[model samples]
Target: MAHRSASGSDRSPHPGRSLAGQLQHLDALRRAMARRHSLNPADMRLLWLLSDDRARTFREISEELNLEQSTVNRQVNSAARANLVQISDDQPARLVLATKEGIAAFDQDVDRSLNGYRQALERMGTEHTAEFNALLAEFIEAYRDIVQPDEEP
Candidate 1:
C-alpha cells in the first residue's frame, strides 16, 4: 500500500527510502543547530575537547577530533586570535587550552542547545523520547561499525 506524505508525494515503505528520509532530517537538524548556535560544529567540538582544561598538543587534538592536522592548526590559530583559547610555548610541543572566554562561550551554547533538546523531548513525552534515544544510540553504533571498523573494537 502506498501512503501520501505531507506534500502529497508518495511515501514508500522500502527501507532505503525510510533511511534516506531519516538521514535528511538529521542533516537538517545539524544545519539548524549551526545556524542557531554561535559556533560552528568544528569549533564547538574543539572547544568541548578543551573544556576539560587539560592542554593537548596539536597532533593529539587532530587525532581526537578526527580532523586533518592542517585544519586543526587553522582552527587553533583562529581560536587563539579570538582569545577563546591559549597555546602554550612549552618547548617542542605546544599545548592548547581553553581560556575563560572559551569556557563561558561553551557554557552559554550548552544551555541554549540543552533547552532546544528539552523542549523537543517534552513534546515527545518521556516514553517516546527514551525510545528515540535508544534507537539513536544503536543507529550510531551500527553506522560506526560499518565505517570505522578499523578503529576501536
Candidate 2:
C-alpha cells in the first residue's frame, strides 16, 4: 500500500531510501577520511594487516578479507609499485610483506584518522557519544538479523 507524507506525496519506499542514504554517508565519510590521510583507507587496510612484518600469501590475504585471489593480486601489485610492499622472489608461498615505507604510511594514516575520530567524539559529548554508540550497535545487530539468513557460506 502506498503511504503519503505530510505533504501528501506518495512515499512507500522512503524507509529504504533512508537506509541507502545512511550507507552512502558512511562511504562518503570513508573517502573524506582517506583524503585527509597519507594513504587511502583501502591501501591502509592491507598495510595494517601486514604491519606486524609477517609475510602472507595472496591466498591468505584473499581468504582473510573474503576477496578474490585476482583482486588481492591487483592490490598487491599496486602496493608494490608504490614501494609499500614487496612480493617474494618465485617461492612456494609467494608471500607479500609490507615495507618500512608501508609501515610509516600506515602510521600516518592512523594518526590522521584517530585525530578526526577524537574530534568528532568530543563534539558529540560523552553522553551523546555513548548514546550514538549504543544506537549504532543496536542498528547493526538488527540489520544483521534481517540480512544474515540470505548470506552464503
Candidate 3:
C-alpha cells in the first residue's frame, strides 16, 4: 500500500530505499572510515564529543551517546590508556576531559570527513543537498517520535 503525505500525494513509505539497507550502508561507511583512520568509531565519537575542552562524567557520555554505562566506562578507560583523555578527581565524580592529542586527532578526522562531504555536496549541488538535509532531519524527528514517544523534550 502506498503512503499518503501531508500534501495528499501517494508515495512509498521509504521511497526506493529500505531503512535497514540504509542503516547497513551507513554502518559500513562508518566502519570503513574508522579503519582508514586506525580508530574505532565509538572511540572517535567519544573523542569528538569531548573535543571542545568541556569536561563530562561517564554518565553524561553514556547519555549523550545512548550507550551502556559499561561500554562507556570501557571506552573511557581505553582512551585514558591511549593518553587521548584524562580522568580528573572532581569531588564525587570523575570528569573526563580530552587531552591535547585527542583534540588534534578529532580535528584531523573531522577535516578528512568534511573534505569528503564537501566533494559529495559539490557533486549533488546546493539545492539537492539542502533538500536532502531537510528530509534527513524530518526522518530523524519522525523516527525519534516513534522510538521514544514519552521522552521529554
lDDT tens readout by residue for model 3, 8-88: 999877754577888899888866766667456777889988977899999999999999999999999999998889999
Residue pairs with clashing backbones, model 3: none
lDDT of 2 by residue, 1-153 (tens): 788999999977667788799889988996888887878655887998999888999999998877898989999999999999999978888999999999998998898888887899999999999998899899888788788967653
Total backbone clashes of candidate 2, pairs 3 or more residues apart or in separate chains? 0
Residue-wise C-alpha lDDT for candidate 1, range 11-87, written one tens digit per residue:
86777678899889978986787688777676788899999889999999999998899999999999899888899
Q: In every candidate, how many clashes are there? A: 0, 0, 0
TM-score between candidate 1 and the true structure:
0.81
Window of ten residues with lowest summed lDDT in model 3: 30-39
Q: TM-score: which candidate is best?
A: 1
* Most lDDT-accurate candidate: 1
Task: Please identify model 1 stretches exceeding 4 Å from their true place.
Answer: 1-13, 148-153
lDDT of each: 0.88, 0.87, 0.86
